[model samples]
Target: MDKHSIEKEFTALIQQYRNVIWKVCYIYAKDRENLNDLYQEAIINLWKGFPKFRKESKPSTWIYRIALNSCITFFRRFSRHPQTLRLTESWDFAYEENVFSSQIQELYALIHCLGNIERALILLWLEEKSYAEIAIITGLSQTNVATKLCRIKEKLKKMSNQ
Candidate 1:
């Protein structure tokens, strides 16, 4: 396709799935500034990978892979950023007020304490993606996704109790 077509298609898809992008960013980001940076990075990564999209998966699936990978990369490279580990307190109120109920807001707090991949899995799970679907999006086996989610749920229980 030509440049204009690519840009137009990319823009439409991005706009259509922007909430998914933002949710991934919101999960990984530590604060407002980090959210902004992660959002930009996710968008750039999506653009760069757009030309190579093979259409073997749904667009949302493809977008999830790109956004999650971008967030993981951003976290690793900028681990020392003040906002890097700020996912909990900063988002607690915002989530309760604007997004999640108190129950899920607490879950988000616990989720921040988990590793990047685990966090991604929980986010996908919370979004009600099937184990097979999450496996495809996350590049894990369906069994592995199930096992990890079980462990994550146990961990969440432990964390919430304390």
Candidate 2:
């Protein structure tokens, strides 16, 4: 529709699903600065894509696709550069305290080591999205989603054991 209507609708959509956007970014974030950068990129991508979003899928599904794709792209783009310094320890604990148990926090740490698509698949599974819904967001068949999730879980188990 009009510019105002589009802005209003986009605002409402972002407000309603900001947590989803943040969670996707959080999963990929290396630190606070990276998290902020990923979030900004996701917001810009969402705005650019909103005008063409069809009603063929749920808004959250569309959001997940956009947020995940944006963060993954942003991450890959930055990863090509060499860093002269690195954080000695992850600041993940700062975010996890009082929010998640140690076990869950450890799981998240292991998740960070996963390949980009694997991390996205597990994050969708953890969000309790239906297999069909995840399939739509991930552009995978339902059976493929199920199979990949099974493998991801097993991979997580193996990582956790080590």
Candidate 3:
């Protein structure tokens, strides 16, 4: 595709999948500024992978793979980089007052404690994706996905009880 056509297609795909993208971003980002940076990283990776996309998988599955890989890589890098600055702006309660239900907010908080791969698996499970789909998106075998998810649930059960 030509440049303009590619841009249009990419824009349309992003618009269609924005919510899925944002959920992964919000789950992985540490703060507002980090979220913004991760969002851009995910989008850039998605755009780069667009041309090579084959119709062998669902678009959502393809997008999830790109988004999750970006999050995992960036999370590792950001954790290693001590000099990454937090936002200096005054505290905003706006996000605190946002419309997500308390249960979801609490879940997000709990999700932060798991290892990165665990978080991804639980996120996919919470989204109601099938094991086959999760395996494809995460590049794991279906059996491995099932086993890891079982372990993650046990971990979460312990975490919630503490």
Evaluate residue 36 in candidate 2 and report its C-alpha lDDT on the 0 to 100 scale. 85
Residues 12-78, candidate 1, lDDT per residue (tens digit)?
A: 9999999899888888876677888989999999999999998899999999999999999998887
Shift in Å, residue 77, candidate 1 = 0.9
> 1-162 in candidate 2: lDDT tens per residue?
899999999999999999889889888887778888888999999999998998788999999999999988987877965222121334543342247656666777788888889989999999999999999999999999999999999998887776
Q: In terms of lDDT, which candidate is stronger, 2 or 3?
A: 2
Off by over 4 Å in 3: 81-98
Which residue pairs show backbone clashes in model 1?
none
lDDT of each: 0.85, 0.85, 0.81
Range of the 10 consecutive residues with the lowest summed lDDT in candidate 1: 81-90
Candidate 3, position 12, lDDT: 97
Q: What's the residue-level lDDT of 154 in candidate 3? A: 91
lDDT of 1: 0.85
Over the stretch 25-70, how does candidate 3's per-residue lDDT look in tens digits?
8777777887778889999999999989986999999988899999
Q: Estimate the TM-score of every prediction.
A: 0.89, 0.89, 0.87
Tell how far residue 141 is off in model 2, in angstroms. 1.2
